[model samples]
Target: MKLLVVGATGTLGRQIVRRALDEGHEVQCLVRSFQRGAFLREWGAQLLRGNLCAPQTLPPALEGVEAVIDAATARPTDAIDQVDWDGKVNLIKAAKAAGVNRYVFISILGAEKYPDVPLMNIKHCTEKFLAESGLDYTILKPCGFLQGLIGQYAIPILEKQGIWVMNGAAPIAYMNTQDIARFAIAALDNPDTVKRSFPLAGSRAWDSNEIIRLCERLTGQDARVSRMPLGLLRTVKKILTYFQWGWNVADRLAFTEVVVGSEAIIAPMDEVYETFHIDSGEITTVEEYLGEYFSRIMKKLRELDYDREKASKKKLPF
Candidate 1:
């Protein structure tokens, strides 16, 4: 089967690409930057240059592809609509025109109830569209990506003083990106997972403190877990909002709601395990994930430091 993976360079998308390739499927990745996807070319994936925001780039990417998997990331509010909702519509249309059959999407868990929340709302809308489109579809609503805990959050803490700062004591159901990719590839390959929204997650749940404790066990460091006050965090958020910079106030507000409204959003790991018939033991525990992640980041930092030291020695009063 010829499968086209959108956002193939992203965290979840990359894993999906690898898993699809491992399953012996011919893969094509729709990437915005040729330079960024150059590495994938060596991995035997046909790299097609395209942007999701640009509909003109869709037809060529969809041409001759039998299946589609979307792991695209989007901002909470309008951006989510723009990407997940609007961009998906474009892709569906193009896929229909190209005579493609299967479509698999990566969504967040609890999207069904939190249609008021920007992120979940957009996913819900997109999911609705996909279901109504008469296309063979499988939707995987995953929990907080374990990869984000490593790539997005933990790397910053490791660079700093081993401080993991979070908003509250909210519990999150997290899952490995590898598992997500595997599920997505399974949906693409098997006919059974179609027209269903599988809630994907790990074997357990953890709050910020518990996560920190596990991190400590992994790195053998008493990592300090700091909680930011809501009022103060909101004030800083509003200030950043005024500047309209990375993660603006609206984004912060939405995230604050997501974190504080955890009771409504959080799902049980057993739910996902039941749907996929996957053993909970097969999933990576928080400790296992942290150990592997920390080692990789340490290697990266060492290489970076070595390069800096060498460059510093070569500087001759330029």
Candidate 2:
């Protein structure tokens, strides 16, 4: 399979590229900057410079492409309306024109229910656009990414910085990007997955307090926790909505509804596991993921300290 992977520099996109290449498929990555995508080229993926915002830049990348895995999304500083809405609309049209067989779109867990939130509404609109575009497509709605938790929780705790959370943050079944990548590639080849939506999730759901305690246990460090009332986020969203410069921040803050919404943005993936022919046990749990991260980080810190001690001892008069 000759595949075009969007957002190849992202956590999930990079994993999908690696898996596709490892599985003996030719991979082409659509990247904005060659400098940013240099590592993907080193991994044996062909790079085509393209931007979703520019519809003309997309078709050339899709030439000779058998499948498309779109994991692209707007960055924090980016204009969400342009990238998520206009850009996605362009990509779907271009893919349909190119006669691409398999199209896999990575979407969030509860996009359809949140019309008030700009990002969610854009995603849901894009999902509808693709579904009605007369192209073979599969939409995977994945829960929170576990790899994201490292910076948001692990590093903050290790560095003794504030780990911020909503007062009553909901428990999320955060799936590993590597595992999500596996399922994405599986969907790309499976005919049954065409025009269907599947929930990609981890084995267990974990809350903020549980994760903080887990981090403390693994790193042997006390976490400086800061709690924000969800009500304040709603108020901030309302104020930021009036300002154009603050649109991105306001769009992000709109995601707070997930924490307070009735559905917890998680799903029982027993049917999904069976459909993809993946076993439930193969999914990485929160504990195993955190445990490995801390162990590796601790080892690196120890090696750095040992090197410094050895250098100091050499300079001393015994």
Candidate 3:
């Protein structure tokens, strides 16, 4: 299969590209800048220079590609309409024009139910557009990405003090990007996944306290946690947005209110496992993931400390 992956530099996109290549597919990645895709080129993926917001840059990227996996998003609230909504619609049109067979889209888990939220509304609208675009489509509504949360929230806090939880007791399932990529690869070729919109989640759900305990067990260090009321968190996010901060305040608040405020974001895994013939045990556990991650961090810190000590010794006078 000849595959075109949009947003190939992103966390999930890189995983999907690597997985697709490992599966022996000819992969092409659409990137805004050639320099950004240097790693992709080294990994044997053909690179197409294009911007999703520019329709003229899309046709060449789509030509001769059998399928497309869209994982693109515009950061902050300002660019959602142009990049997330319009850009995707343009890509769908280009894919249709190029006679592309399958279009796979990555969307949020609860986007359909909360269309009023700005980011969710845009994604929901794009999902509708893809469904009606006269093309075979697979829309994957995945829960919170486990690696993403760890990188953004867990690692930084664990390195300093403790993890912060907006609602400590809320049930949330964190799915690994690797598993999502596997399912996406299956969707690209499997007829059973065609025209199907399904919720993807990890095998288990954990609250914030459980996550902290897992972190403690993995790092063998005291993992402190700070909890905040959900309503208070929302208020702070709103104020941050009002101040025009660079962070994606609107999207963050929506995620907090919708995903974090709700019970576990999950679906029956047996059917998907059976259909794709994937093993449930293959799904990564939070402990295994955090253990390896913090180990690397600790190793790097040790190296830095050793370098500093060597430098001090060099500066010492006998």
Which scores higher on TM-score, 2 or 3? Answer: 2
Segments in model 1 whose C-alpha atoms lie over 4 Å from true places: 75-78, 151-153, 160-164, 233-249, 264-277, 295-318
Off by over 4 Å in 3: 152-154, 237-248, 298-318
For model 3, how does the per-residue alpha-carbon lDDT over 1-318 read when each residue is reduced to its tens digit?
Answer: 999999889889999999999999999999988898999999999999998889999999988999999988885544667898889989999999999999999998878778667788888899899989999999988877888757545675567665667764466678889999999998987888888887888878877777777776666677566777878877777777766553466665765677666566777778888777789899887777777787897798789999998998795475
Of 1 and 3, which scores higher on TM-score? Answer: 3
Where does model 2 exceed 4 Å of error? 259-263, 315-318
Q: Pick the candidate with the highest lDDT.
A: 2
Give all candidates' CA lDDT scores: 0.76, 0.90, 0.83
Q: What is the TM-score of each candidate against the true structure?
A: 0.83, 0.96, 0.88
Clashes of 2: 0
Ranking by TM-score: 2, 3, 1
Whichever of 1 and 2 has more lDDT, that candidate is 2
RMSD from true fold, candidate 3 = 2.9
Residues 34-115 of candidate 1: C-alpha lDDT, one tens digit per residue: 8998877788899998877788999999888999999987644435557777888888788877888899988778777766
With a 3 Å backbone cut-off (N, CA, C), the pairs that clash in candidate 2 are none
| Position 285, candidate 1: lDDT | 70
Of 1 and 2, the candidate ranking higher by TM-score = 2
